[model samples]
Target: MAQQERAIRTRRTILEAAGAVFDEYGYASTTISMVLERADVTKGALYFHFSSKESLAQAVLDEQVPFGAVPEQPCKLQEIIDMTFVVAQRLLTDSLLRGSVRLTVDQATPPGVDHSGPFRQWAERLIALMEQARSQGELLPTVQPRDTVELLVGGFAGIQLMSRALTDRADLAHRVSVLWSHILPSLAVPGLLLGLDSKADRGLRVLSAVPVS
Candidate 1:
């Protein structure tokens, strides 16, 4: 048990170090030596945990995926949107997560390794959440769950990319709100618009407070 605990801690240290380095100097410029130097772990320990840098990179990517206990009961569409925004905020605030997001966006178009699993898994979870919302009559009858999932994921990805470029210039919340306001209304039932609108307003307010950069 002690051995396992130490291994886990070592792995976490490596991930944290890698994330910081990646954030400081993008994937192309980052090096294994830098990761080791940042982590302060012996080369043997790193090699023991991960066979190669790509594997370590994959580990870093895996660590960033949002996977926590969600509400047991069905969540309102607005609630889900708020939760998603909160997760985004966390990612934006976390240096490691921020670096991971940058790396993911950079590698999304041109795959170098097998780090896509986390993304696909994230998309799948969103799709499942949408389906749940649909079953609860939270979505409009006209809204296609799959399409909504695609839009939400795709739009979020686009915003993440934009956030990376405009890290110091753009407010993530405002950008998210603008995109959400435009896309959300169309995805909800007529009577549900009021709730969503309120949520969007709140989301906008919350996002406005998030510092750019």
Candidate 2:
């Protein structure tokens, strides 16, 4: 148990060091030696945990991606939206994660790496929630769940990029709130707006290792 605990601590140290180095130097310019130095670990120790730099980068992504705290509940539209914003805020506020986002966006189409797993998982979950909401009549009759999911995810990603570029000084929370408020009225079923208006009654909930920005 003690050995396992030590291993866990070492792995976490490596990841945190990698994130810091990547954030400071950008991914393309960062090297394993730099990570080793930052982590204060021997080459063998780093290799024991991560086979390669690519694997280390993947580990960083796995560590940073935020997951919902509400679990897979009844899939109410408002619930999903609330969860998304919570996760978004968590991601946006995290400097490390914002750096990760920058790396992902910059290296999304790297030569042999499939970087779409996280994005696809995010879209899939949102699509599932939207589909459930559509079935429950929470969305407009004309709203297509798949298309709306695409739009929402795409728009959210775009906004996040903009927010990062602007260094989060533009009141991202307020802007996101306003954007959702305007968009929800169009996407939601006629009487569902009231429920959405009450979304603030529930606080932001998220699951991730990084601190909220």
Candidate 3:
């Protein structure tokens, strides 16, 4: 058990190192040597966990959908808003998340480097939130959860991409707040919509509430 736990720790260290390198250089420019140097582990140690850079890239991509610090809300739509803001906040500070977002959208990956899992996970969460909002009478009758979720996912991708390019994502939370404020009125019932927390710091407050380990 001790050995297994140590292995898990070692693997996490390596993944974080590799993610940092990926974020710095992107996939095509990233090399195993860079990750090895950053990880401070022998090549054999890296190979025991990840055989190649592509495998590491996949692992990093899989790490993107971490839903940290989102306490359940009376309004399900609030939960979704919280999720977006938290992710934006994370994108700014978390190397793994920043790496994963870039890797998932980057088209120059080696052939068959699939990032469908993260995208599907995002869709599932948004769809579930939309469904919950419907149950709580937060959504308009004309708002189809699946369709709205799909549009939201697409719009979020574009907004983050533009933000990353323009501001290195410094304005991500603000952009996301603007996005929710503009779209919520159309999709949500007026009563619930007015009560939603669409501010940029919505997720930051949730994050700040958790004690740092």
Candidate 4:
């Protein structure tokens, strides 16, 4: 058991080190030697977990999803809003997520590495919530769940990029809140709009509300 645990820790350390390097150097310029130096792990150890640099980068890219017990809300729209805020809040400090995001947007990756997974995954998650909102009569009659989700996901990608450039994403939560304010009116029913929480600190509140595991 102890050996297994240690192996897991070693794997996490290597992945994080790779992520940090990828974040700094991007895919094309990031080499296995760079990751080894950052991780301070032997080549044998890295090869045991990841066969190649592409695989390591893909692992980091796949780690983009946020993990936690975010309390589910009765209003699916609110739940969706909270989800965005949570990501925005975490992006401020989480190096793994930051690295994943950088890889997702970087255009220099080799042809085999796909960065579209995160976007598709986010779109699918949001579409599921939007569908639930529609069933609950929370969404506007004209709002199509898939369409709204696509627009939102694309808009969010752009918003985060702008925020990253402007303030290193320090203002991302606020920008996302502003985005929801403009988008919710068009997406949600009137009654739901008034009750939804789109505040900037909502991400912090949502995360804090989760009991420590």
- The numbered model that scores best in lDDT is 4
Give the Cα lDDT of each candidate.
0.70, 0.68, 0.85, 0.87
Clashing pairs in 3: none
Cα TM-score per model: 0.82, 0.80, 0.94, 0.95
Put the candidates in TM-score order, highest first: 4, 3, 1, 2
Q: List the residue pairs that clash in candidate 4.
A: none
Quote model 1's TM-score.
0.82
**TM-score, structure 2 vs. true:** 0.80
Error of 3 at 185 (Å): 0.3
Tens digits of per-residue lDDT, candidate 1, 18-125, equal 888887787778889999999999999999998977777777777766522234334557655765565566665566676676677655323555656656766777
Question: After superposition, which runs of candidate 2 have C-alpha atoms over 4 Å from their true positions?
Answer: 71-75, 92-96, 197-213
Q: Write the per-residue lDDT of candidate 3 for residues 49-151, one digit (tens) a residue.
A: 9978888999988788774347778888888888888888888878878888888887777875676667888899789888988987888899999988888
lDDT of 4 by residue, 145-213 (tens): 998889988898899999989999999999998999899889888877889999999999999887775
Best by TM-score: 4
Deviation of model 3 at 108, angstroms? 1.3
Lowest lDDT 10-residue stretch of candidate 4: 62-71
Q: State the TM-score for model 4.
A: 0.95
lDDT, model 3, position 155: 87
